[model samples]
Target: MSYSHLLLALSVVFVWGTNFVVIRWGLDGLPPFLFATLRFAFSALPWLLFIRRPAVPWQKLAAFGMLLGVGQFALLFLAMRADISPGLASLVIQVQVFFTIGLSLLTLGERVRGYQLAGLALAVAGLAVIATHLDATLTVKGLALVLAAAFFWACANMVVKTVGRVDMLGFMVWTSLFAVPPLFALSWWLEGPQAMASGVMHASVGVWACVLWQAIGNTLFGYGVWNWLLARHPAATITPMALLVPVFGMGASALSLGEPLPLWKLAAGALVLCGLVVIVVWPRLRTALLRTNA
Candidate 1:
């Protein structure tokens, strides 16, 4: 990638990474489901007015929207609200890569490579380490919720793969539209109308900014630039930049939220990040080794 493009990729990941912190900020004023509802609502409206919907079936759009907006983000917001710190949330959610692999194996009959298995094992170990160390910042409920969110994210990935290539931005916008009603219903049912009303009424300007950031900065701009880069470059070239997300997530959490980076947390991060590295890098390495042997 050229220097400018690399910087662009970095900016996207930075937005994505810091998004956990933004979610934390938003949750301070709004209930989780309500926060999610507003985020998707803004993400879809006005833009969806002008942008044409992708050619995919409405069913597909609805499914992806629920999985992403409700299953993934709603749960994620809930977890962040009470259970997990933003830093760890950012790190732990990445287990979705492994979940995606596992789902593909079962659903699509895709073969798993040794490196993928190795990566899974390493990531599992890291998660186990986290499980053993739950405290004020990291709770059992938080970890479980985030893991569930990761599974939902993997499911969303399957939806995308099934849909094949379409206008990703349009797909996201339309799917986001489908996500809003259900999320509002969920907020009403679970968080209670009183809570939602109170949150909205009492929300600060900063909280609203966080909500807008989630819609425009994190969802639209982040994915917009990312897809643009993928269109211009190979997936292998573009995708690996995602590894920086957790690094930035943890760093931002520490810097912004004063989240502590204890030694154990560092070790766990190393293990998980190393596993991700192996998963992303091993295929390229294997191909290069085969050519060398030839």
Candidate 2:
């Protein structure tokens, strides 16, 4: 990637990394489901009117919304609500890589390469280390739900792979469109109508800022830059920078939320990042170096 594109990619990751902290703040004023409802609701409007809808099947788009939006965010929001710190949530969600690889193997009959298996082992060890401390800070239920969210995210990626080419921005808009009603219904069902209503009515300006930032900053601009970079560069080149997301998340949470960074947690995060590098960056580097030698 060129310097400019690299910078753009890093900027997108930073926005996404900080997003967990924003979600925690938003949940203070909005129920987890309600916050998700607002996130998709705001993301779909005005801009959705301008973005042309992609030609992918409506069913595929709907599934994408269910998996990535409702499924992922609901679980993630609840995970944070259970006292999982933002930085830790960010790191744990990287398990999506293992889930994606596993799903691809099962659904597509893809072979599990040695490198991927090694990465998976390291990733699992990293998660186990985090798991050792979960009872003290975050609940087991919360950790399990976050893992489920990561699984759904992986499933959503598979849906994207099946859909082939699309207008990423429009797909995102329409996915949010698909997510709104169900999320609101879930807000009422799970969070209770009265509680959700009270949360909505009593929400502070800071809450609104968090919601809008999530809609515009994290979802819109984040995906916009990501899709742009993907269009210009190979996915291999563009994606590895996202490994920095947890690094940013850890630092930002420490600075802003006063989240304590224990050495064990940091070590786990480093292991996770290293595993990601092994899976995502190593193959490309090997190929390049081999070409150079030849």
Query: Against the hidden reference, what TM-scores do the models get?
Result: 0.83, 0.84
Best by lDDT: 1
lDDT of 2 by residue, 89-206 (tens): 8877867766666676688665766776676566667767866776466667777888899888778767766765568788788877888899989998988989988988999999
Clashes of each: 0, 0
Number of the top TM-score candidate: 2
Query: What is candidate 1's CA lDDT for residue 213?
Result: 93
Name model 2 segments beyond 4 Å from true: 1-10, 116-125, 223-244
Tens-place lDDT digits, model 1, residues 153-211? 77887776676667878988898998999999999999999999999999999999999
- Candidate 2's clash total is 0
Candidates' RMSD to native: 3.7, 3.2
The C-alpha lDDT values of all candidates are 0.81, 0.77
